[model samples]
Target: MSLADSVSVTVKHKSHAADVKPPTKTTARPALTRLERAERFWGWIMVLPLLIGLAVFYFIPFVQNIFYSFTDLDQFMNWSTFDINNYLDLFSDDDFYSAVFNTLFYVVVCVPIGLAISLLLAIGLNQNIRGKALFRTLLFLPAVTMPAAVAMVWQWLFNKDFGLINYLLHFFGVSAVGWLSDPDIVRISVSIIIIWSSLALKIIILLAGLQSIPRSIYEAADIDGISTLRRFFCLTLPMMVPTLFFVSVMSFIEVLQIFDVVFLTFDRSMVESDTMTVTYLFYKNAFYLQQKGYASAITVVLFIFTMLITLVQMAIGKRLKVA
Candidate 1:
């Protein structure tokens, strides 16, 4: 071959060799170490008990409740054939409607008022005021108190003839009010008790939220000569949205299921129709009236209502940019 031909042939061979690349090797994930494997196994072991308990206690019973709602139960608690009559009867019952109305009234009256008062109390306690720790303890005491005891205390305070509340009213020339008896005023009376008892936990929550806010923000606002009132409206409120949202949601759920106050404060003979909450009504049906299937249906309705309300609150919170 000529020298140029030999050089050209060598270049062609080099180019062809470059084009034919070597096969790539597949990479496998590294095997976990024995320690890591043991850690994972222990983690699962720790969580398994909780999962089992939840399934056994909560999930299974919840499913059974739903099933029972669709089936009639005889006096002996034996399940009968499936039926939708319970729901039909529930819709037509005036007592059911009254209970629903009363429950909604509690929600509407208690939650907002409680939230406002709680926020104000939290702000006051968060200040550099003396005895704040004592105040906090006193405010939070109600949250830890038994619901039945609290109801009993308020029942005495609401006595028409000789209660402290009526005594004070008489001093101001107002007539003695029937706090637990009259249909027109008993709802408000119960609402007052609910709001009072709920304030403690809400105040604690708001106080924590307040403490989480950086002091530097307030210092900057002070440097700008911002008034405390202005700062609260412009700065504090915007920052407290998440905490407020949480408190409102919890309050709504709690108030919707109010039973203790009504059950403890009033009897079947004393304006039961006016004071009956959905939960109270459920208790009456399940235990007192032997209407287990009907009570189950009430619970299902309550569950649906709670879920819908929670969804609406979450949507509103997202719209407001709550964290």
Candidate 2:
């Protein structure tokens, strides 16, 4: 009786557990929090429009431009040839070499001058000076002024007949010098314009960099009896290497791509044929001569040069900092 009763109770207990059912063997997944899910959704939503616009406007055109460079793309659309002939022609073109030289010269001249002027201004303004704001405003005016207007004013000022500069030269009993006509002087004149236009932004950036430097460094240098020039070289400049590098690269890049001011200054002048830049050549070939493929090739070359220049500048910056 005891064995049968025990067995029956054990079977009843097992039957009850089976009927109650064990949990299913489903894998557990980590569910994102409500805030996380919302953030992910909004992040995509925010970036989607920009990505789309970039693909449509920039990426697509860039690819097309490169493709066109390999082909004989003309206004008539008659030539279907695709080869490296355009690049070969570019290498052989005398005008291309001239443009390259002019462009490099512009970069070499304007970048250092612009940086020096901006650095000087920024350093002067960083000190306590009366009417500092006024000086900044005056210096920055050229940057805000329309390039066309600046060219007009400068042309008149440099006019050999009655321009202000010539008038001043006359006051000194010197004959009026041709400012815009001479091929030799044209690049110098253009460089001046480029420096004037780019000076203000550089000053502002360098000034910010100066301000970001800790006052403790200067105080420590003063206690060490470092002279003004020594402190500037040892303390200020080393700290500003990053900013200087940034400004130098940007300035050279802008000078290399110069077109607006050149067009304004010389496009209508008799010496228009003298001051040619690579960008100007690009415009001329693509729009005027309708040599689209050659123009595209020039643009590709320019892009590569820009990248190489940026890398070289970065390397030089690191080396300078180490030294």
Candidate 3:
């Protein structure tokens, strides 16, 4: 063959080889066995009821609440128009501002104090101490007790004239203090109850976290001659970050919605402007005043604020994990 002919023949052979490539095998996924299919079916069946309950109780009402917030809906659910007046009034209302302040105060005062006390209690209880079980049971009793009963007991304890607290204070030459009635002192009084009641569960959770820490790690720390405080800060705390983050987020959310203790502890007359939290404000509007629309608006703001706070915490937690 001539040179050009030979080149053309080679190119033709290469193109033919490329076009006639071997067939590739494609792997097909094996069909699930009958038992595997049955397992998945039962798993979904087990969760279906919970999913239905959540949709009915949480999701549907949540969407409806958002819609109602813009309307002037009454307790009877009657409304002629939808407007932004509820939100507008919410921003301008002094009571709303007061509620916000009170709620924030509870969050600020309760979360850190509760966490710290809970951590200390957990640490102490985690040690091999005498009567530790009894102590833990005593501490955890409040968590299982009814809120109404707890409130009733705390109310008596907080009584100005004859309460245990004031009686003790009187011994120190301090005059009687109106814990529930005085606006200046009521927040602190309520915070005391909140922190006390919340400590049991927090202690239990922190104790679990403490127990979960590996013994070998601590033994290594001891071998290194690390001081207790240094071990905590350098080893224990970093390991407990995830548990701490969980507890903190839960505590923040719970404190932000403080209502039952305030309501049951104080009479209606004593639930004044200074002591009213956002949840209590919502309750008063929704039930007492029959202004469901305005109540919904209040809840919407609270929901947004909660979402923002939780997001911020999660972001901070992500950074901590990365670090």
In TM-score terms, which candidate is top? Answer: 3
- Each model's TM-score, in the order given? 0.90, 0.86, 0.93
Q: Write the per-residue lDDT of candidate 1 for residues 127-174, one digit (tens) a residue.
A: 999998999999989989998889788878999988999999998999
- After superposition, the stretches of candidate 1 with alpha carbons farther than 4 Å from their true spots are 1-29
Give the per-residue lDDT digits (tens) of candidate 3, residues 1-323. Answer: 79999999999999999999798888999999999999999999999999999999999999999999999999789987899999999999999998899889999999999999999999999999999999999999999999999998998999987999999999899999999889889999989999999999899999999999999999999999999999989988899899999999999999988899989998876775668889999999999999999999999999999999999999999999999
User: Which candidate, 2 or 3, would have the higher lDDT against the true structure?
Assistant: 3
Cα displacement (Å) at residue 207, model 1: 0.5
> Alpha-carbon error at 267 in model 3, in Å?
2.2
Candidate 3 clashing pairs, residues 3+ apart or interchain: none
Which portions of model 3 show Cα errors greater than 4 Å? 1-9, 12-27
Which candidate would rank higher by lDDT, 1 or 2?
A: 1
Arrange candidates by lDDT, highest first: which order? 3, 1, 2
Task: Write one digit per residue (lDDT tens) for candidate 2, span 88-182.
Answer: 99999988888888889889899998899899999999999999999989988988898889989888877778888878878789987777887
Q: How many backbone clashes does candidate 2 have?
A: 0
